[model samples]
Target: MHLLPSNLIIFPNWLQPEELLYLDLERVIKTIATHPDSNKIILFIDTTSIYEEDADLVVSSVLMNLLLLEDLDVTEEYEISLLGNADRIEWESIVSCIHARIILENENQELLTSFLVKNIPSYKVEDLSNIPLGQLVFNLSKKLFLEERWKEAITQYQKLLEMQSGDADIYWNLSHCYRHLNLLDEYFNTLQQGIKLYPTHERLHFSLIIDFRQNGRIQEAILSADHAAKCFPDDYTFQLLKYLTVPSIYDSQAEISFYRQRYTQGLQNLIQRTSLKTTEEQNSALAGIGRLTNFFLSYQAQNDIDLQRQYGNLVHEIMAVNYPQWCVPLSMSKLQPNNKIRIGYVSHYLHSYSGTLWLTGWLRHSNHESFQIYCYYTGNEPDPITKQFQEYSDAFHHIPDNLPAACEQIIVDKLHILVFPEIGMNPQTMQMAGLRLAPVQCVAWGHPVTTGLPTIDYFLSSELMEPKNAQEHYSEKLIRLPNIGVSYPKPYIPPVIKTRSDFQLPDDAVIYLCCQAPFKYLPQYDFIFAEIAHCVPQAKFLFLRGTLLQPRLKGAFAAIGLNSEDYCVFLSIPERLDYLMINLLSDVYLDTFTWSGGNTTLEAIACNLPIVTCPGEFMRGRHSDSFLKMLGVTDTIAENEAEYIEIAVKLGLDLAWRSTIAERMSQNHDRLFDDKACVVGLEAFYKQVCSKH
Candidate 1:
């Protein structure tokens, strides 16, 4: 090959008979861009071996000739011929552009002749019905799928289905398209069809369960998982899912005890099975185990500090293997204080969730010159508030879905202090939080429970929220900041005034709204509801059915000799505005025991409703009590369960007393709403912690 300039390579030699015929077009393009002389007449023999040096060299020669063609006369004759299997000529443009006249002299090349005739508009300009159907369909559909043109991909797959009936893979692809388009009904139908076509396909069965769960058909989801587990006994993941999908609702003390036993036995078995494995092997096994353990631990009945600590220790062992501590401990080093401290916040809930509501104020008002804030969001969905957090931070990163990639990026960022607001809610973040990725790793009360990981150096909490002896509650050093550590913006009240009839309530009834999720209601607290109902006949408690726990709630009520239907009305999950409206409309806000409402408590205050709180032994149970105390309203903070019922009933019957409490709430609204001193306290704590290092 004679190599020419103009970023083109030309072959000076003819093709050898034994060479491969395929042209690597990608390499040819690279050659054409780097050669020097643009204008050159390149000669090619009839049988030019694309394998001479590389087919890329031939493509470069041809492309260069075309580029220099503009400089020459249009009538300038450049005679070139490629005489290989003509059907193998993938690039028709090269054949058309490099020659003034073309001739095909094959008597029996039917496929090649037909292909050119069908594809070239000037020759035949016809449909390709005679072409092999499967190749064309596969290539087109695959291309469309790769480009993410989901609708067009669906159309291509549909055409494939018409040509080849009962293809399970095609149905799978179509179902995926429906899912991406949010045509959930179609997605389900397609998956069902796929399952019919290929009955034992594990992926399709698993996907059916996922689709059901996504659409909120919890019972069906559980059934599907249960069936899958029974079908595939060796796959512990399906069995784990079966256990997990069972609603965290206990009807009585017996059920609670039974579940606790199962949870403990399950954890011990998982730990033993993965005991002698390598770290990667252990991590793979622990994925399902971690989820099962975390879910059971979250239920109020299984909230044992020792079990939590044990879970943390197991997680720490995995972290020790998977994400080894590579950083020198900051506490051991003496450093100058002139440099700005690099603080990074890691969480999956940096969007319009509870974590954002509590942490946004710190980002908005923190002294940027003193602290460099970096937010690493693991959440896939980003909202307007997520953008706000991005704007306030010095640097923001959306951590990739791949766990190792996210950890690598965090390690590269080299944060001085890494804070995870709530590590328990998401598996990926929880796994990452267990790793020591920074000098100082701290966790906050977004989930409002101790992480119990040895890698977690400190538990950042509010002084008001914790009990008197809170140090014993956490595995890490408990650092209590003043107030809740952030100033909250005023919540929006819905403008359209809703009436009692809008929610199927009687006008004469005294509405005591218990707006917490159903999972927060412990069976132990069910008697309190019965007591309140008995004490105040007009007290109608409102609840939101966020979980599939209504039957359990009613069973608990029945245990206490009360009819749940007469005492309580369960409402569907509402939008933010509707939820606040319900809070505003109610006569009193009854806080849940144990897992108290952190965000709802703030909402109750913003709506100026009288709240009755009974704080518990742990910080998780005392948020509303803390808020009430912060606002200087202690009358409703009951010291015991009896007092909780007494205060709720008093607020129910004594209209004047209710009004007085409401007035006091309204008067101290500013104190409860936007306490900027909280941020100052947080900053001081941050400085103190850094100074120690």
Candidate 2:
């Protein structure tokens, strides 16, 4: 009956070992009564590992006894510490017996307030702010939402709805939680509920429309945007959302052309709409376009310079009107040779598994004395890579999601140069790229697409990745950095070894791994898989599971007289260790034809997997090809789609040839990784840009 130094405790379970169930309860109660002299009593239910039906009944019985004890000693503090999901507990059934509710992992006061408010007769919670229970819960939910604890935040928001208290903002936050958690069905349902209850809530309506577009429901997305535009004629954002909307996955290349034309027309319409608009009106519309980048357009494998320039100017006009002081080009005095150049990097991807994977080399090996490094991050998550950035930074600012505040802070730093490592991927970065925050503003190939912003002075790209005359493809002055344009660290090979069977893949099959996302696999290139299957009997293509786009590829196979179910394997995307193994086990790495792989291809190379890629028009479409060229292995580089399919089929049939190429890659990987020459070229380029400025 003695309480030990360890806080671990056991509970009764009637379902298992029923003969001792009675004795179990008796001993548990005896221990509690003996331990009660400390004036604190706790019933800890750690269901994270195991849960039984009798847990609630035992907790109830124990609580009932404890409450009776509390009557004898009213000052004894009683609590229930929940180590697992709080939802499984029947709180309503046992609320009367509880003095406090504790969620161990999530130590927040909201649960206590929730407990006190629900059990109104027995307990009371007071606050200096005098906020109501609903407001208190709302505030905590918002805090959790900002911290990206989606599930916990969802639980807090759901409490408001359960208590017959809800609002548009609550629903909006709930919808976002579900969205991040990939509960699309629940996400849509929450948005619908919010929209129906608060029909005129502009943001709620906007969220619904944006959700539709992002989910690949093109018709519904466009229709909702159009409807909202009509409802709020003054809100040009809704109209712009409709105008800029493109398909998440194209049915065919023809669809791409169709959307491209629509996009061009949309730009024209947007131009006229902003021509005479007031500054306030234009600024209000910035959110519509600024809230999203034209992300999907790069997948089409076409030159975006003209359209991008048009859109860039369109955005610039609005920014210029709204913030004329900031929009004006920055004035600068010529820097003396010995003065440390003040350089700034503004991005949302300064973390691992992001575009920073390439930018890290610059941050890691920069000339700290010559360059005063300033990293302004728009993301909150701080992983190992982010820590490296912080360690190297002269000043590190993890800016919240506030565009104006971020801009003002950067301007106050009076940076001589600003670099956006990646643009046209994140909306906030995209919008910020449209403004002239520094005297010499530049962007690198984070997204591998030209930003087209006139405010941008240069486009830093990889000489290896750029096609001949690549400047025609970009709106900014192009500066091609040497080699891969990154002093990329060699990929860390995990020691965990796995086989094909671990992923439920056939051990005997010739697996061609194409691990790109669903939208990246345009239907136009889906036939390439079927054609490879036509020649190689043992060919089995592996893809990441995306239910929505599976049918599109399946239908493409069907058109080619092949049943996709037989030749195609879709497994849920694996953890990082398994992803590396997928590349290692596969006979050939089939690169997505138009938009070539970046990090995945780098990983595949680390595994010595032979990559078959066809270079396309733009830099984004040429990552793997350039990587192969750097490795001195160009046998797998295809000139066209025909050559791409031929090379892929050859790699499948000729194992010896594939092995030779893989061997060559392994030997020359040194040429690809940890090449400090890129930093040298970049520093020289930086000096050149600054001198010109």
Candidate 3:
């Protein structure tokens, strides 16, 4: 046989020979040759066996002649053949020739298209009715998913699962689609089904765990995490997930230590398994460890600057390519409503258990005849305090939904100053503040940290809360209220010494009481108290039990060598304020680091109980420090853990000095109760926000 040029020789394997006949190939080849000046002639052939040996020779001869034309046309042909009994022998040889020619010419699409035109429809659907519709539906669903049409994709996958029930992968994909759509309930329901169908699937279990965590079912999340750990024992990601999830459920000093140990072990294992010599690998490891470190630091009572900086650097590195939120100067022209200034307070903590409890006194006593107060409560829980705040306001509105919607309403209200009582603490509240709903948005004591959002115009601070130069670290403008902190109506009278004996502690034992949240016990603060316990052997540490001081949290303290029997006493008082005033039974109050007690510290000072505070670098941390200084009680200031222990012990030991400080603190307490002064400062701030240049 006279062979054509290798480029012009179409391979049999490219054709669907089982379906296409010889006539199809002949017509395709003739069409290409008709155009002599065509740069490329694509000829698609069926299997070599479909044509007789003589016919093959004739086709080869025609292709060779076409290649030799005076114009030297670029002639190409794709000869596709199916592997029947006879064609298998030539399939390998033809495929090798086609690949070689493709490499030489660097062009194959035209030739491939010609082959498809002749034979594709024949074998593409051998019997369309017999095709697996489930698979077809799955493929269609995947296409929709890639297009970001999650709802449409979910519908298609649902149809596929209905047709072929118990497909684990289908259910998994459907769950993923629901998650993308933010249909959390549907996501969990689908995941439940997926886990039921494929109980052994580790990825599905991990997804369930993550969903539980995000939805606030921490205990269920921990259980799911344990399941994932068991299924994927060697997977470092799963192990880390378990370690990270445990802290959210059991947020105690002991749990913190437990998770820290696991984190360190898992981190070591990950480092050893992965080579960190490259920048990418090092960065990934750093990011992972940095997240774990943050979780641990978050549970600590004190802010760790080094730890925070590490986390911030890692976040910046990861998000360097992403855009940041736009912060613009707001125009207050529309903030004031026709000769009246409207102040809006947005918070999720407006209920009974809130800093709003402190605001109740101010609200009850404010000169409401001048400025109008509007409260936007995002929380659903209605309590006496919430009702009181509503009554105090000129106009009160429930947020009805979330922060964004609430902010929209606040903007419509044309509020001159919008105050955020819960800033960094409530995620939704922070999101609302980020929207810049008012011309002047203020942050307050509901959260102790700098909101870190630039939209907040000012921070409601007192000399006791944020000292001089402290405002530099905050993003908001500082508005200093008169006195150290706001005072609420002290309704509960201090219980007598007999009430203290009922808690089983000696009435005479120098009591060192801390009614703050148990989570506030930083490791260093724990050591400080432990040192004090060692110094003042007769002193008993009393921790008033509230929402945070559970048995598990107490166990955490036990793990750190402070036994419940020895130093820790958990007592639940009938009335919080009344019980708080009973701190008088305890000679001295020890303030926790990071979150210094506002109401609790105030109550302590009011009941003539002197509090020793060690202020940290942050605003939330400096409240007690500021309060002590404003009261002219500088001896109560402790610069570090050692000083905290020293002062605590000295106060417990020296009866005369303790009584003198308490008497002095009582006089300072009188200054703190000047609600009129606070009102004056607050009114000025409101006017500033409402006044235009």
- Give the top-scoring candidate (lDDT): 2
Q: Give the worst 10-residue stretch by lDDT in candidate 3.
A: 98-107
How do all models score by TM-score? 0.68, 0.78, 0.54
Report RMSD (Å) for each prediction in the order shown: 15.2, 9.3, 22.0
- Tell me the whole-model lDDT of each prediction, alpha carbons only: 0.67, 0.75, 0.60
Tens digit per residue, CA lDDT, model 2, 1-693: 222111222322334553354345444444444442223344444443345444655556655655585443222443444444445255442332222222222222334356423332221112211333455456557766887978867876776687555988888889999999989999989988988888778888888877786677878887887778877777767767767888777777788899888888887886777643666586676766666677887777788898889888877877777677788878765788788888999988888855767888887889987889999988777788888888979999999688888999999999999999988888888888889999989998878888889999899899999988898999998998998898777888775488788888887888998788777778777788888998988999888755556677788788878888888887876477777767778899888877888988888898899999988777888899888888889999999989988998899999899899989989998999888888999998887778876
Top candidate when judged by TM-score against the true structure:
2
Over 1-693, each residue of candidate 3 has an lDDT whose tens digit, in order, gives 221222123334323342242333343344444433222222334333444554456555555554564333324433322223234445433332220111111212443454322222121212222334344456557766776768767866776676568477778889989998868889989988888888777668878886686554667777877777777665534555665453333443575567555545544453345444556654444333322323323544434333333323333332222212213445676533546677788777788764667777667777776677888888898887788889989888887545446756776887777887755455456446555566677877666555545466677877556656766655566777877546555535455645665667776788888787655655434556556766777777787843334444345446555654576676767676547546767888988887677777767777888798989767767777876776678898998878888899999999999999988877765555535667677787678666642
Candidate 1 structure, TM-score to reference: 0.68
lDDT (Cα, 0-100) at 537 in candidate 1: 82
Mind giving the per-residue lDDT tens digits that candidate 1 earns over 308-366?
67777777776666556542353423345667778899887788898556788778888
- What order do candidates take by lDDT, descending? 2, 1, 3
Q: Which regions in candidate 1 have their CA more than 4 angstroms from the true location?
A: 1-247, 275-283, 286-293, 301-303, 325-337, 553-562
The lDDT of model 2 is 0.75
